[model samples]
Target: MKFRVKKATKNRTCIVSAAPYHPYQRCKAQGHVEFFSDFNKDSLFGVITFYQHKYENKVIVDGIFTTDIGIDGIKTSDGRPRYTAELYNEDEEMIFDLTSAVFNNAIQLVSIKKELINLEICGDEGIIGKAVVLKRGGEEIARAEVYRLDPIV
Candidate 1:
């Protein structure tokens, strides 16, 4: 059997070319959720999108694509409710995924401590790498890049 491949468009992060079955519909119908804690003990959940693809003649999944921001629920000292901006990605197989949680609310707060973001990539040799960033907002976050160093070795 022959296969057709296409590059991802500017607006499209992931491109699904010719396949035995359709994967877009399957991903759209399914939703993956993740929960994380902020510095102040506030909780947030991220809903991820899952998709299936043909990699190296084998069926593999590109799981859980999301942005850095998850839920937009914030709290106020006066017992009021505040909403933050929501972040989303257009490309299903985009390069990065980020999630953040807020800590002590302070004016001119440049950064806070939070959980790491998750990144996944399917290499050309049928190897998959998953990475995570640990730190808060801004720079100085601990990042762990994982992948098979050498398949041939």
Candidate 2:
């Protein structure tokens, strides 16, 4: 099997709309909402096109991707919403899986080719720069880089 990977960001800050708008309007429209970076944007969400501002809020967020802001589910009280990141082979079948990932924050995995990875994350946040690997059964498939980002002023 093969896998592709990209550098992902952590604790990335971003602005979100705070108001409500009618239709066919961009986030810049009047009466729309705006939210400061009270949330940490994670790259594990993989191309977040849109997501609910709050798990119980009706607001739909077209969170900015250029700055890579928002979308990979924020810190849940009970981590109720679990995510499973899966890897597929040429036959389009899943082989490896990462279950119960915190906030289900899966990295922006490459989808063009194949790869092999090995990593450990039993007790992360202990190591300064710890990495993780995804495997299928006993075969290595992908790796994830865990790091923080400095605010770019």
- The candidate maximizing lDDT is 1
Q: What is candidate 1's lDDT per residue for 11-49, written digit by digit as tens?
A: 877655576654332111212223344322234322222
Overall local distance difference test of candidate 1: 0.31
lDDT of 1 at 126: 24
Task: Compare the candidates by TM-score and give the number of the best one.
Answer: 1
Candidate 2, residue 80: the lDDT equals: 38
Clashing pairs in 1: 13-91, 68-98, 68-99
Query: CA lDDT of 140 in candidate 1?
Result: 26
Give the poorly placed runs of model 1, Cα more than 4 Å off. Answer: 1-33, 38-41, 52-71, 74-129, 132-136, 139-153
Per-prediction backbone clash count? 3, 12
